[model samples]
Target: MAQGKLERTGFWPGDARLVISISMQFEAGAQPERGASGPFPPLDPKYPDLPMQTWYDYGVKEGIPRMLDLWDRVGVKVTSHMVGQAVDRHPQLAREIVERGHEAAGHGQTWEPQFSMTPAQERAGYLASIASIERATGTRPIGFNAFWLRGTPNTLGILQELGFVYHIDDISRDEPFTVPVNGKPFMVVPYTLRNNDIVRYDSPALTVDAYLADLKAEFDLLYQEAGRRRRMMSISTHDRISGTPARVRALETFIRYAQSHPGVRFMRKDEIARFALTAPGVPRS
Candidate 1:
């Protein structure tokens, strides 16, 4: 029940601080494929808006555990956006998440599309995703991050109606904001594509050094500006992309380097949302 006020709205962080929230989207085989051999069936472009990975074949079987090990080695807890289809394929993955002490929230049942759908369609998609996650994990997912970047009208309302605590579909700005959903300011944890390792997907060299340098630069700037701005840095990652050995090595180095700075707190999105609800203007817990 910890809540923080927004600097512009009411509260402001007096301390110069930064929160590092790492988002690792766990899809065993949920990534969309450009070819027919995309690991799973064809991507669902209609209601669910699913990706092209054979989630069950890859993620649950080998992907999640591997990523978990990487996080564990670094002593970092991730906010894993669980894809339901993969969950159904690898049910014990949920148990493992709970056992390992990470937050398992919704990434949609199958990592599908709900952003451009009609209100009813979007609502249906949300509900279906939520139920599937809850049934499989025994913990109702409260955080949602859509597969595609698209967000729809009434999305927050629907999320709150279904008892979600936070959502990360928007990147309109760099900082977290509150949406007045259902009369209360529901938490919006801002996510960014910059800190993600996916940026290296099309790069020429595709080396971990590039990723580390970029991540270090972002954290360095944010850490220095801790006084002027209440900041949180999020690194968006995936199994097939960031889960690889090279990227993980880069991530490990950056995490250690960032931790060297004083007052850099690392927590899940739920923890940030809880803090935001209580201490809006404050730098962070």
Candidate 2:
């Protein structure tokens, strides 16, 4: 067996030092419902997961508005990975995202895992997700961030067939690169959980201060490297996680710090995808 290496590509728009993308996950109704079908069994016999559902609803009711205001203040365009059912439930929210000039990228029909689905099932889900989002936002997404960022072997091919220009299912590279699908190049815009607010829920050690500090350190290194060899950084957030009052401050602080640096450009995922697809100096798959 042999190993494959991902070479760094010093390419980006406007020859900027670094490309920073703020990715927000809006998965309200898309989350697994109580007693809903999934690869795993329900924790309790209930019709709706009241506790979890309300937590997710808070994002739509308060979290999203607060985050949007912060982003507006920061003057950064973010890419939102939304679930179809969530969009359907909150059509106005979906429209608000587009009207705000942010990019809406696909997540899935629901937050369920895709790896367990058969090829046929995955493809069907993918199509339904695309259609639902388009119906809500009036624009078909050009990029996809699979549920929990998990994807099956068929994800990329299906994405390519469905006209997606890029995918963020990979965290292997800090910079954008190409992966061949159907003998055609597909852009892989890397995503990371390193700076995501979901960490607050999963890890007790990752405090708001810790998350802010980590973001600053990550941005500093990337900004420096980007000077010589253009770099890109992805900051993943959630409406439900980063939308809270305290957590939102951390996100706001990081964006402010990143903005203070020179030659740092904020971009949407679709913008990154198009750049990688058409930019010079980017290596082919």
Candidate 2 residue 128 C-alpha distance from true site, Å: 1.3
All models: lDDT? 0.71, 0.82
Q: What is the TM-score of each candidate against the true structure?
A: 0.82, 0.90
Off-target runs (Cα >4 Å) in candidate 2 are 1-10, 35-48
Which candidate leads the pack in lDDT?
2
TM-score quality measure for candidate 2? 0.90
For each of the candidates, give the backbone clash count.
30, 0
What TM-score number comes out for model 1?
A: 0.82
Best of the candidates, TM-score: 2
